[model samples]
Target chain A: MRLKCPLCGDRDAREFHYRGAAKLMERPEAGAGEAAFYDYVYLRENPVGANSELWFHELGCRAWLCVSRDVSSHEILSVELADAVKRGQA
Target chain B: MVDLTGLSALEGLLPYEVDGAVLSAVSYGAITSIMPFRGQKTAVNVRLKADGGAALPRIGRVSGPVAKRLIWAGRGQYLLLDLRRGAAFDTTPDPAFDELAALSDQTSAWVVMRLEGARAQEVLARLCPLDLRAGVFKRGHVARTELAHMAVILWRRPKGFEIMVVRSVAQVAMRRLSGAMDSVAAQAVLGEIS
Candidate 1:
């Protein structure tokens, strides 16, 4: 299957791995609590609709992408990067 | 003992899983000929039935040929040449790829598995992340890539993709793969060309 890369536009899925979803949830920092870190890393919401996620192109360009996909059909709706700084805005 | 400076052996490469399915590794060495069918390799992978009968279609075929005698024997890749023939490599009427293809076809007698099912794609996805959907990996196609931390030859069959990982890594791959498929289990020995 082919995918529209966030940085390079459309490329084949053979070049990228599906890491899934852009969960901005962050850990509560060190000493905040082990349970908090565990829950944040392990827990995930498997929504099956238009959603955003992360993908690493390990074999290709090796760029991290924030992809908007339809989980139900595994169709990629759109793709972007997690780095807000790439947009150069506040 | 021939001058084997870097030739590797494939022993203990295939290990039996607790559930009883066998995983294996093999090596196809030497650069003999190149056969590309529809841009795919047709190396037949099969499994035997509980009744010792043939079950399903061939796993894959070899499109590009690398050597003459190919062996799924153990855990490593082997490139064999008939050194007995003082004939130079690939300078004869009968090419190396043709001979290897015959050997690959004869192995059809060996029971093999299609390794296909609902989660077959999922199992493969965990290995190479190639997005093995319907359109991408179609029947009669083949790919040589790294899977489950090992080099593997994958064939796209009608039923499911058949793959042979490094025999030494078979056990580890099987364990890691059990978690990939949502389907409960897979068969022990799959048959061929049925």
Candidate 2:
């Protein structure tokens, strides 16, 4: 599979390291309690259809990307730099 | 105080040649990495223009003259390669734009190799997965990719290709590239025979 990096254009998936779900984008506050922290750290949704993921462009731009893909078909729907996503720019 | 002398990582194993390719070490004096601070790209470009007579290069492009080339390494990152032998840039960030950009010396971190020949593309195709067909990856293009599991920065030149690998993996890089060169040359020989 190939991913189109926002800055480096399209690249082979082998150059990227899959970093799991993009839910890490949202973190519970320090005072949000034990269960909140537990859910944030360990509870993962077994997403089946449209899924958002985090991938590191290990060999290319070294940018963290938030990828929205169809889990069942492996079709990539969108790719954005994690920085931009975190900044609400993308 | 202990005295130290700098030696090339591939001090004796390079300048290798075969029927179709030549692999040799490049003594790139100093490589400086320039990373613009967030929202300071324009300011950094202004400084770069005033300093090097060239602006920051676009993604996958190279700018400036052969002596002091600026290569786009990744998003907001540029590598300044001082090609003049014995010339070195300050490892510390220049005070001119200390806040606009972050500068770091990469001379000791990377080892460069030049591969040029009639079959240079074939030799590289055996290891790198990039599309190297003529006109596709034209001159002045740069890409960060892998060659034989080792991360490498590849730059396309008018005559051939320049590969930059980490210093620690220099030997493995040479071994793999030379092996590819031998394989390509052997394939050509067999073709000629048949």
Candidate 3:
């Protein structure tokens, strides 16, 4: 498989590290409660179809990316910089 | 104090000339990494333009004055290469824009090398995974990737290319580059015989 890095262009999957769901970036607010913190720390959903994920271009541009991909077919619909996504600019 | 004047990462095994390319260590006056402070990119760009007469380069690009090249290292980062001042360039942040950006010396952190020749592309193709065709990776293009498991920055120059790798792994990079050159040379010889 190949992942197209926004900065480095298309690169082999070997150059990237799959960092799991992009939802992980949304941490709960400080002092939000134990349940919220627990969910944030350990809960994950195994979605069957389309999913948003976080990936690190460890050997390429070294940038974190948010990739919208299909779980069943492994087709990537879009890729954006994780930082931009965090800043609401993507 | 220890006498450490003539030390180099390659230990004198540089300026190697092969059938298709010449590998030589680059002696730069100064090398620094510049990173714009959070939300200060615009200010940093203005400062860089005032200082170097050019804006920060986009990803996979390079800019700056002729002798002092600014290469985009990654997100929000650039590597400034001042060739004319080899090892003597000041690395401290210019007081005029110290609040806009962060500057760090990288001269000793990296080992710079240049590969140039008519067949330089062929030699590089053996080790690099990037698409380096003239139309694709044009002059002034930069790429941060791995060559033989060693992280490296590849910059396409007008005549050939420049490669920078961390000093800790410079020996491995040198060996791998030499091996790639030899492999390409061997292929050429076999093609002629066939």
Candidate 4:
């Protein structure tokens, strides 16, 4: 599948590596307790429908992307720069 | 000071030619990577124009003349090169752009080459997956992509394309490009008789 990089345009999927769920972006506070930290670090939901993911464009623009995709159909719903997501711009 | 000899990555393995395409090593006196400080892009562009007679290139574009040009490397990153200068890095930071952008000399970190001729596109199509048609990938367009599984920055020049590969894999990149050239040339020869 081809993924459209916000900066580099459309590129083959081989150029990008899937990091994990987009939830990886959220980090617990230092005093959030061990259970909360453990859930943040170890628990992952394997949803079958629309899922937000983190992908790194290692070979193209080197931008971290937040990709919304359907897990069952493999259709890419939308893509945004992770930086922009963190900044609440995307 | 010790005497040191500067050698290009493809020192003795370039200037290769096929039936219609020619590949040659390209040397730059200095290659500087310019990445603007957060929210300083406009300031950096203004500084670049005042200092180099060119502004920062947009995505997949180049600024200035061939003698000294700034080519877009990726999002918010650029490579400025002096084509006529010696192959060495100028480590000094220029006050003109230092505060607005992060500058680093990258002269010896890459192997640059120019492939030019009528059939250069055909030769490159075999290795790169990008749609390189003249209309699609017009002149001054650039892309960070893979060429034969090696990361490269490919750009369209007037006649052909310029490819920049990491210095460590210069030989491997050369071999892959040369092999593609030969394959394209042979295909052309076969088409003539059939």
Candidate 5:
């Protein structure tokens, strides 16, 4: 598998590390119930189809990437710099 | 003061010449890492242009005066090298850029080497996985990749290429680069024989 880095272009997958889901998790506010905190920490939706994930280009640009991919088919739909995505510029 | 003249990482292995390339250590006046503050990319570029005669290089590129080169070193970072003198870090903080960026001396942290010759690209191809064809990786292009399992920064020059690696792995890098050079040289000789 290969990932097209926005800065470095397409590179082998060995240069990147697979981080987990890319969805932003909301932390419970102070005094929020334990159940809410527990769910935030432990619960994750196991989507088998298209999923947004985070990856670290450890050996390439050293940028965090948000990768939209198909979990079952391993098809990468898109890759964007995580910082740009968070800033709404991607 | 301690005698530090012979303490360079490539003290003994440099000035190595092989069949198609020459490997030599690069002496720089200063090497600094510049990281722009949040939302200060334009400010940082202006400051760098005033100081180095060029703006900060874009990703996968290098730019600057002949004496000083600014190499893109990953997201929000650049490695500025002054090659005219061999002094240590001596740049006074520019107040104009103080709020726009941060500068850190990286002179002793990295060891730089230059590989140049007609067949230098072939030697590099033996170790690095990047597509280094002349058209693909032309002069002024930069890439951060692994060479022999060690992280390295590579930039193309008009005559050849420059490689920068952390000081801790300088010996290993040199060995691997020399090995690749030897391998390519042998292949060229075999091709002629057959």
Candidate 6:
């Protein structure tokens, strides 16, 4: 699949590594409960749709990217750098 | 001469404490295939067009005694390979398999970190199936090896070595690697870790 990286331009998926949804973990809330901690560390949520997920370029320039795509249609909605912190997409 | 991460923790007699090479939280990009090629004094890395799109990047050929070593294919396009080193090529000829191979190759979501220090070899030995001894591995070598029980591609550089494993294996690998380096760090510099 092809992803348009906002900073690196359109690149094949081979250029990046998927890290899952942007924010999936909360740094164990200063001594959280056992169940809550287990959920955060052990469980994973796999969703299919247009979701904002995190990615890294392990092969290319090594940049952070945000991508919105469909699992079925193989269509990409949008892609940009890890600039979500600067643009406030976070 | 400089101590690095994990140095002081081992024997506790280390000049200065070194941490081996800690994961800096930097991104090495997603799973990407690396192509290593070389000529006489130069080496080039090119990422192949693995999706059945043939993009052959042309580089000048090696220079030798023109009267002898000029074996010619004449009109055909030449792809340069540094015979001094082993070259990696895209072996996947299947389109459907390319997408999945990309993921296995970490073409989707992954990070690559370069780990080296006085404790480099010790750290790698703990989790890698490959031997990290200098006698077996000199400089300018690369391999698709395994780390922390995951398939990885490791390239040996001058200073130390660089390893790329899956992101999901990060925390676990780090714990094991750090502990391993902490086991060493007594004498050598472990080299520079980036």
Q: After superposition, how far is residue B75 of candidate 2 from its true place, in Å?
A: 2.6
Off by over 4 Å in 4: B86-91, B192-194
Candidate 3 lDDT, B85-124, residue by residue in tens: 5345566656776888888888778998898887788888
For residue B167, what is the lDDT in candidate 1? 41
- Per-residue lDDT tens digits for candidate 6, residues A1-90, read 877655434555655689976554244675788988777767766667676667875544455766766766768887766655536743
Error of 1 at B35 (Å): 10
lDDT of 3: 0.84
* Runs with alpha carbons beyond 4 Å of true place in candidate 6: A1-90, B1-26, B29-108, B186-194
Candidate 3 backbone clash number: 4
Best by DockQ: 4
> What are the per-residue Cα lDDT tens digits for candidate 6 across B1-194?
77544311122321222565443332321222322222311111112333322233222122222111111111111212211211253422334433222212323233445576656777787666555687766553444444655555455545566554555665565556556666555333453432
Range of the 10 consecutive residues with the lowest summed lDDT in candidate 2 chain B = B84-93
On the 0 to 100 scale, the lDDT of residue B10 in model 2 is 96
Taking candidate 6, what TM-score does its chain B reach relative to the real chain B? 0.45
What's the C-alpha lDDT at position B40 in model 6? 14
Off by over 4 Å in 5: A24-33, B1-6, B86-95, B192-194
**Higher lDDT: candidate 2 or 3?**
2
TM-score, model 4 to reference: 0.95
DockQ of 2: 0.74
Query: Across residues B1-194, which tens digit of lDDT does each residue of candidate 5 receive?
Result: 88566478989788888888988899777788888999898988877777646898888999987678899998788988887553554655456767888888787789999999888888888788888878999989999997877889998877789999999999999999998888888888889422
- Looking at candidate 1, what is the lDDT of residue B190? 39
lDDT digits (tens) for residues B1-194 of candidate 4: 88898878788888999889999998877788999989999998788777755888888888889888889998778998876653364555576786888898888898899999999999888898899999999988889998888889989899899999989999999999999999889988989412
Query: Cα miss at B83, model 1 (Å)?
Result: 23
Every candidate's DockQ is 0.03, 0.74, 0.74, 0.77, 0.76, 0.01
Per-model TM-score versus the true fold: 0.32, 0.94, 0.91, 0.95, 0.90, 0.34
- As a TM-score, model 1 comes out at 0.32
Question: Judged by DockQ cut-offs, is candidate 4 incorrect, acceptable, medium or high?
Answer: medium
